[model samples]
Target: MAFPLMKRYFDPWLVRIRNLLKAAQGRPMALVVLFSLSLLNLSSEWPSNMGRPAFVGALDEAVPDSFRTARQLLFDQYQRHFPRIPTAQPVTIVEIDEETLATVGQWPWPRNRLAGLIDAVAALKPLAIGLDIYMPEPDQTSPDKVAANLPETAAALAAALRALPSHEAILARSLRAAPTILGAAALDHATDTASTDLRSAPVLVHGTDPLDSLRRYDYVLASLPELQEAAHGQAMLSVTLEQGVVRHIPLIMGLRDKVVPGLPMEMLRLATGSSAIDVFADGSGVQAVGVADVQVPTQPGGDIWLHFASIRSTLSRYVSARDILKGTVDPQRIRDKLVLVGLTGTGTTDMRTTPLGELVPGIEIQAQVIETIFEGRFLRRPTWLKWAESAFIMAFGLLIIWYVPRTQSRLAVFLRAVPKGSAVLGVSLHLLNVLFCFFIFVRLGLLVDAASIFIILSAVMGCFFAPALLRGDDPIKTQARDAQGREDENDRTGKAPGP
Candidate 1:
């Protein structure tokens, strides 16, 4: 009686297991298992291929460019939809706008006119004034040029010209009197020449050979020697573009074996009365650049990821050059403010594409960089982020392999198997990964690409289920076979089969 009871208890489960094995034994099912395992193996190699160009390119293409655009749009929308931290530090832009050009005349205005504008802004006692314009050559409207054209009174005119200072000299005097930071450009051409008279700001390095790993440039195009000497500080205005968009700005750039500060960095130093910039690095590369008490985190090559705010929302930040020069504007507006003087008139060719869309001024880009650093809110991808992503992909892939097969087997045995279940699981996993990445990006300002992992998950599901769904023996056939076997067993035992 005990033996009969034990047999009754184990017989049904044993039969189900045997049917599951029979359904999963055909060539079609074998191929599915083989393909799924192959994908698992391929996924294990993804981390090592992270640095390869082909692998990187493929990962970039995995998500459509439209998705990137949409991501940016979403970022903009969120910033607009939410309330931001109120800033106590005032930063202003003295723009050479269309209205200013129409009022003060077109660009390349007489050096005296520019000198007057500087003097007017200086009177307000701003924190620091940065010139985004480059003065590479002598002014065309100088006293000497005017004297040379008046040949009829050449002898007397030469004496008058000598008595009156050159336009450049007047501008230099104004620059020396005011708090000014001059901007320069980095060039890729090896033969490019920079002003030897201009002095570079002092840099103090805190690690072994940090400059060796920085983004190196062949030469720099700086301002005129006299002007550079007169300015309080000099900074490189070089900005690297990514796919025609301004995403990251370099805080320090390498020039002929020497490291130089970028415009935003130098301006901050001058504003805070810091004499030298302190760069901290390790074997990996530069870790941070410090000015006074503020330290900014940077990439290995001294690039900082910008957290952009919409220019339209910050329109009050700009003050027309004409208004500043005419003394009609309120002095309280710019008093103790950090002022950036740059050209923003139409056709200036200084516009850039930002996350907010096209036609952003290059000056605003630098302003945003300074703002981001000052706020200490940056977007960064930690060194271990990729490792975390790779580990996640591997673990999830293995889970699917283990869990999905058992699920399919059980479903097939119950005559309830369907392809939709696997497809639904794959899509749900994809959506969960997307939501996780989005949360990290918005909350912590970390960007981790989940597209590659999604691809791996989808592929694994497809390989595991496609063959089984298409060519494997139907669940109905398995059910029929089990019923017929039960009937034959009952006939041999001389009993009636159950309905």
Candidate 2:
């Protein structure tokens, strides 16, 4: 009796709900609901939190990190396959490979040996030499230092060794003679309070103060005073990584509260003999970095999106240090090129993975940066792309929602003849959107988040189609219902139903 009463009361309400759902699948109301959902999606992705309420943080967290990560991975795949033919051949690497280490003994080779290496490279007259090595402390291998550690039994020998000229002094003379840029390491933790001398290129700021937009360092690990003062310039030998891959290198960064150029930027400055670097910025942050006549578009924090060439490309030449030291280097190879000196030995710690899946020396990345800037082939992720993606998801989702319901309406008789035709139409539109994003990336070098667009649309399609799937109605269901009604009529008339 209770079941009968419950069904009697709920059946009318269930019919009303089914009727409401069918109406929602039509115009005006469907568009409004979809538009409202699209706005909610866009609200969560607002770039800045300035004008929003407190709950936005919660909403943002609701969007899984996996989605953003997948989006980045998709972009990485695009870059990996993209063909980038470098137009400029401005950088060459002087690699200290396994052969060099074996021939010249292990790394931290006596500063006197390094002095000879510098002299050899300088004799060829490269445009500028960048030493991508950090010499934080005085050389312990210096004769004087070695003598100081000797036992009293070797007093005479110690005295003889100490009498020889200091190793750093010899290296300093070589550095003074060559146009060299010494590499400095960036540190996050503060060290000595007394400020040591730091060399920063003159930066002309055009828009807002960029101090806040730059990557900050508490201290800089610079070379010894003698060698640092002798070098033409000192720059940070640091790189910025995303997902453990070297994708962008900072052109300029903050060190000890002062702006200093990165290794690549300093190399560019010295090669072009630029007096200062011009930085253009706005409310959005740094827009570009200009050195002499070469201006590079940069991300907000003075980082350029690196356009990495294929590993097989010989655009940038690499000369072994062993060859350069042995006087076998061709003058044409080093002449007028910005030479970067770094270790690429098997056991070296500076090896980093590139987007191309090669483990390259950190110095090679710096060379790539210089080449990218010189060629002006930049990959840009514009600020407006997010809004455009949001709009696309809304418009495309609304279109599909409108199209799906029309497939069953008398107004779309052709569509009604096809079984589940709306799904097929929606999938085609999705494929077109994917191809459109690919074309934009290939033709314009624009980085669009196609993954997010796909995710949003897929969710919208799933939700819109879910109710109909749950109802389990089709041409077969309508025929079965008609047969059941006939059987009921036959049973009421006391006539046996025939199959």
Candidate 3:
């Protein structure tokens, strides 16, 4: 048969097959195929986009660029539609900002000043106070400052924790007393630590190879030995940032075969007094729990999903250290509040630029995560989620075959024709997967990555329409044959050929 004739005859059948595949009942088979593909892709990171521009363009009119209000709208919308109400173990912040400098001191303010800040926040008598700041090493000027001032700070901070003696020992220590998590970013540039401040380091949360990722990091070790000597608990606030957004913070990483916890989990242990933290990540995703003794096996790496909280909600509630210092804010309000040491300064430039080029506040991001942990609401995408994604695609692909050719409405037609279906679908899969990791069941802890979903769509399209385009190349020959058949029918009907 001629190429055009062959294609013209075959195109419709292939399209029908696509519809049939969508209508396929047992999708677990497809899941098995896709899941096997995922397993073969054992690399730890999501595949990079070769045509990132095209992918971005697909989202151009869809996802607008607006950090301040856009991000808020997204969270609120997600909360409303998805409604993962966070069970926040409430905490406050003593942001080290310009104003904080005015009230407290400069960037690397004295250990005594941090001691006072601890005392002030300690007065709240929270379940625990966590320092997001780091104290990896000791201070030069005060060789014994962290150690020396720790006792003094404990003395003053003790006043607050006295009522709750356990709170004092566990919650009031500056990197020493409070359930502590230190911030440390792996140095991005191999520069001298000349102007380096050990207060807090930027962190990179996720990537394929930890060494290959250009995700920035900063060291948060303490500058005072005295400070280092007095803490009850300590862990890294390590981040695996993407583009620039601080997305996932690994609860722990492999270093000389040592197991560690991230900042939030460590502090959670202090706040809740739980000795065991169950870490879960199988085929679906990762989950962290503050049980007395967790039984999940250790992988070579880990990153706890960020349980996000809305920024407006976070800022409306949290008062800065500087505000508390000047008495602009009443201490009574913060009394019994769990406070976090963070950075939300105007000039802080503590902004992470996302793939979408949106600059988000690092502190606000942490606040959201804190709320996620506290609320027990996490986004989860299990291995089953990928199967679910494949199912959705197949189902929709069938619907497209049925509905697209018959539907007359351009609006409906546009919806079917565009990639929007894939976006909505992809986002749904990830949201379910990630959120589930933070809050409830960490089932099928597998990372499907966005690439898998894209691949599914491509496969469906290639199967469905490659013939349609080929058949269109020879419309004349196809139409001629179609006319000849119609003529035969007309001759049998004893009538002229229809126009």
Maximum-TM-score candidate: 2
Winner of 1 and 3 under lDDT: 1
Q: What is the per-residue lDDT of model 3 for residues 1-499, given as tens digits with 9 covering 90 to 100?
A: 6999998998799777544533332133344444443333222222232223553444443433412233223333333333334454366666777677666656765455666666666655665666666444444334333334456647655454344423222223554544444444443344433123432222223223332212224333332433434655555555666435554556554332234455666666666666544544433223333434422222223454443444534555567787765567766556655556776667653666422234655655555555665555554433345446456655655554444323234533443556455346546755664464323332332333434444444444333333334445332233334446666888899996433
Please identify model 1 stretches exceeding 4 Å from their true place: 1-89, 190-198, 407-419, 465-499
After superposing candidate 2 on the true structure, give the runs of residues whose Cα lies further than 4 Å from its correct spot: 1-23, 26-66, 190-197, 401-403, 406-416, 468-499
Tell me, what's the RMSD of every candidate? Answer: 11.1, 7.5, 13.2
lDDT, residue 179, model 1: 91
| Candidate 2, run of 10 with poorest lDDT | 406-415
lDDT of each: 0.73, 0.76, 0.47
Tens digits of per-residue lDDT for model 1, 248-316: 799998887788899888988898999999899877778899899989988777887677777765678
Leading candidate by lDDT: 2
Candidate 3 minimal-lDDT segment of 10 residues: 42-51
Identify the runs in model 3 with alpha carbons over 4 angstroms from their true place: 1-89, 135-181, 186-226, 280-288, 292-301, 353-358, 391-499
Q: TM-score per candidate, in order?
A: 0.77, 0.82, 0.55
Estimate, for each residue in 317-386, the C-alpha lDDT of model 2 and write its tens digit: 8899999999998898999999999888887857788877887778778888888877878888756777
Clashing pairs in 2: none
